[model samples]
Target: MLKWILFALCIVGIYFFFFKKPKTIHEKKEHKKDSIMLECATCGTYVSSDEAIIQDGKYYCSKECAQC
Candidate 1:
């Protein structure tokens, strides 16, 4: 019984040490920056796109944003 209890405790400890926490503060901040909602230059609305237009070193949500 004691051996089984020790094995269980060791397993729990290993799990907590390895994969328990979600992310560190620095990682969380980096993730938040990556997930920032970009603003549409045309309508001034928030958008979430992987690729933002870069013209004259400015960010635009889409082609419509360039027109505006």
Candidate 2:
């Protein structure tokens, strides 16, 4: 009886340490989508494509920079 109980506890410990811990750690990681980068035509600053302003075939960091 004692041997069976010890074997069960060992199996549970192994399962928790090897399987459960890694699953939770992987699930908690934040995955960000890839973004394109473009250099500002005025100041030469790099900005993400989504936030950049496009004008006359050039990319700008902001509306003010685009006008300049």
Candidate 3:
């Protein structure tokens, strides 16, 4: 009986620790609204602003893509 109780407690603890329902992906992304997202001018692929190169108020994923 003690072993069964211990096992149940352990299961509940694990469930709370791992599956307590943190923010969903959309919620987390929406939380960072001020952060910039750069879209490829040519191909329209989305990339993070930090990874993009800025020139003339336009964001480029790479110099090669920018040239095309």
Task: Return the top candidate by TM-score.
Answer: 2
TM-score list, all predictions: 0.36, 0.50, 0.44
Candidate 1 has which clashing residue pairs, if any? none
In angstroms, the error of model 2 at 45 is 0.5
Model 2 C-alpha lDDT per residue in residues 19-48, reported as the tens digit of each score? 765445557545465668999999999999
**Cα lDDT, all candidates:** 0.73, 0.89, 0.80
Which candidate's lDDT is highest?
Answer: 2
Query: What is the alpha-carbon lDDT for the whole of candidate 2?
Result: 0.89
Q: Rank the candidates by TM-score, best first.
A: 2, 3, 1
Model 1, residue 3: distance off in Å is 46
Q: Candidate 1's residue-wise lDDT over 1-68, tens digit each?
A: 99999999999999898886766645543454465577776677676756677666666788778766
Would you list the rank order by lDDT, best first? 2, 3, 1
Q: Cα deviation of 8 in candidate 2 (Å)?
A: 41
The CA-based lDDT of model 1 is what? Answer: 0.73
- Which residue pairs of candidate 2 clash? none
Off by over 4 Å in 1: 1-33
